[model samples]
Target: MAQTDVDSRNAQFWDELCGSGLARSLGITENTPESLQKFDHAYMGMYPYLQPYVTDEDLAGRKVMEIGLGYGTLGQLIASRGCLYHGLDIAPGPVAMMRYRLEFLGQDLGDRIRQGSALEIPWPDASFDCVYSIGCLHHTGNLPRAVAEVHRVLVPGGKAIVMLYHRHSLRQVIQIPVRYVRDRLSGRRRFASFGEAARAYYDTNAQGEAAPHTDVVSRAQVRQSLFRQFSRVRIDSQNFDTYVLLRGRIVIPRERFLNNLARVLGTDLNIVATK
Candidate 1:
C-alpha cells in the first residue's frame, strides 16, 4: 500500500518548498557538473559525511535506494557511482524536479523517482542492498514505522544509512523559546512534557510555515525506536551552528566560534545500521 494518510499540511508545505525552488535557495544554478559540485560543497559543508559514503567504491553496481531526493545532487552522485538508484519522496514536486534533473543528466530516471511516503515504501521485501535516508525520516507522520520499513526492504546483511535531528543539539536549544512563543501566540496553553515541548521546538518554522512533522529524536530514541531491529548500529553527528533561524530566511551565516561550538553540540544523528 502507498501510505496515503500523511498530514495534508506536510504535503502542502513540501509543495510550497518545491514551487519556491529548493535548489535555488542553496545556490544550485544549472544542471551541470560544476553546479552539482557547487551544491555538493554547500551541502557537504552542512552534512560533511555525505560525499565519502555516496562516492565510495562499494556503491558501484550495488542496488541502492535513497529515501529523500533533495535537489537531486546526491542522487546524481549516486547514479554516477554506478548504483542502481531508486528515490522516494512524499511530495510530487520534488519527484518531478528530480525526474527533470535526471533527464537533463542524459540518463532518464523514467520511474526511478516516485511520489511515495517513507512510512510504507512501495517496494518488495528484501529487495535492496542498501537503503539511505538523510535528514528526512524524522519529518514523517510515523517515524518508527518508517524505520521499520527501512529494515524490512533491505536484504539480509544490507545496510540502512539514515540521518535524524538530535534532541540535545544547539538547533533544538535555539528553537525552544521560539516554539514556546509561537505556540503561545497560537493559543496553546502548556506543554505536556519536556520531550513534547522539544518536539514542538523542532517543528517550529520562523519563515512563514513549515511541514507538520519536523521532529527531533534522541540517541536513546534511535536505539529504541529508529534502529531497534538492526543487528549493528553506529551513530554519529555533524553541523552545529552554521546557520541561525530568522524571518524571511531560516538560515543565516554565523561566526566561526558558534559553528565550532555546534561541533561540540552536534545537531544530526548519522545512523548506519546493518539489517
Candidate 2:
C-alpha cells in the first residue's frame, strides 16, 4: 500500500477510536478537568513507571514536544510543569482533543499543537530540547524515518524519550501464539504468520479496531538501526498486567519475582536517547 493510503487509514482508525474511548466506556465520558484528571489517574495507575521519567528536573522550562497526544493526559502533565509544551498527532481527533484539554487547563498553546505524521515532523531542525512519545512510534509505518524526524527536531544533546513495543516480549513470545491459535480455531481471523498475528493482536485496541500499521522492535534493532544518530541510548522494559491495579497501587501477585521478570520480558520498551 502507498504511504499516503496507510497514513489516511491510520488517521481514520484513530479518529474513530480515540484514545479516551476506553475511559469513556469506564464512565469517564466528559472532557472536563475532573474527567481528565480521572483519566490521568487511571492511566498513571496502570503504568506507574511513566511519571518518573517526565519530571521537573528534565522537562521544566525546556521546549518539549510530544508526538502523540493520547487524550492529552501526558500533554497536560507536561504543560503543567512550566515547559514550553508542544504536541503533534497524525490524526486530527487527538489534536483537537488536546487543544481543548490545554485550553481548559488555562495553557492554551494555539498553533503549537498540530496534526502531522511522525515520519515527517512539522518542525524545523533543532526545534526542541526534548521529544517525547509513548506507544506512538511503533504505530508509524516507517519507524526509522520517524526516529530520524525526532532526531532532527531535537537540538544537539537533546533527548528523545520514547516507548516502542518490544519484539521479544513475553506477550509476543507466548501470549500471541496462544491467542493466535485460539483466534484461528474460533474463526475470529486467520493470520498468515506469527508476525502477522502479533501485529494484529497489538494493533487491536480496547475498541476492537486495529490500527493501520504497527511494528515491534528489539533493543538491539533500536540502538543499531533506528537511533544510530544518537550519541547515547538506553532502553528498559516495563509492563504490568492491568489486573494488578488495586486502587491506585500496582499489587502484583509475586511483586518482586514478576517485576524482575517483567524487566527482562516486558512488552513496553522505554527508550531514552541523546542526540
Candidate 3:
C-alpha cells in the first residue's frame, strides 16, 4: 500500500478504537481522582518493560510534551513531578477522560492535554524543553516524518526520549506467528480492555489490539532517524527475561535476576536524542 493510504488507515483505526468506548470498559473514568492513583500502580507494575530510560528527575520543571497519551497515565506522573505536561493523542475519548480525571484531582491540567495528531503536531518550532513519545511513534505510517516532527518541536539543547519496538528481539520473533493464529481463532477483531489485551499477550503470545500498527525497527535505523535532527543520541534496550517470565507466569525467585538479564539482552529499544 502507498504511504498516504497507510497513514489514512492508521488514523481511521485509532479513531474507531477510541470511539468504541473501550477506554471506559477498561475502568478508565472521566471524573475520578483515584483513577490517576490506580493508573500509577498499573504503570509501576509494568515498569520492568519501561523503566530503563526513565529517571526520577527527568520531569522536574521541564516543559514536556508526551505523544500518544494513552489514559494520560504517564502525563499525570510527569505532572506530579513538577514538569509542565502537554499530552497529545489522536483519540478524543482518552483526552476527555484525562481532562476530567485531572480536573477531579484538583489539578488544572486539562489544557495541557489536547486531541492532536502525532504526525502533525499543533505547536510552534522550538516550543518545548523536552518531547517524548512512548510506544507511539511506531504507530505512525511515516515513522521518519514523525521523528522529524518531534525534532522540530524541541528547543535547542532540548531532549526527547522515544521508545519503539525492537525488530530483532527474541520475544517478537516468537510472538508474531502466535498472534496470527490467535487472531484467526478468536473471531473478535480487536481487544476491548487492557486486562483482556494483557491476557491475550500472555496466553497467545500476541500483541492483540496493539498489533495492528506495531512496527519493529532496527537499532541502527532508530539511531539514524534520531541523528538526522539531534546532536546527541543514545540507544538502550530493556525487558529481557523478566518480560518473558512475567508473560509466561513463571514463578521466578529473584526479581533482580530478570533486571540483570534485561541489562544484558537489551530487548525494548529506547532512543534518547538532544536537539
lDDT of every model, 2 decimals: 0.71, 0.82, 0.65
Candidate 1, residues 1-275, lDDT tens digits: the string is 13354545556556543323434776655556576667667765655556776665388778889887766667777777777888898777667667766665677566778887887798999978988888779888788888999999999999998888888786676656666767878988566545556654444333534446666778888888678899999887665554544664776554353336654567777788999
Measured on C-alpha atoms, candidate 3 has an lDDT of 0.65
Name the runs in model 2 displaced over 4 angstroms: 190-196, 205-207, 242-258
Candidate number that wins on TM-score, 2 or 3: 2
Report how far residue 235 has shifted in candidate 2, in Å: 0.7
Worst 10 residues of 3 by lDDT: 199-208
RMSD of each: 5.2, 3.9, 5.9
lDDT of 2 at 102: 80
The ten-residue window of minimal lDDT in model 1 covers 14-23
TM-score of each: 0.77, 0.89, 0.73
Clashes of 3: 0
Q: Which runs in model 1 stand beyond 4 Å of their true positions?
A: 1-5, 17-37, 178-207, 242-264
Residue 2 Cα positional deviation in candidate 1, in Å, after optimal superposition:
16
Error of 1 at 150 (Å): 0.5
Clashing pairs in 1: none
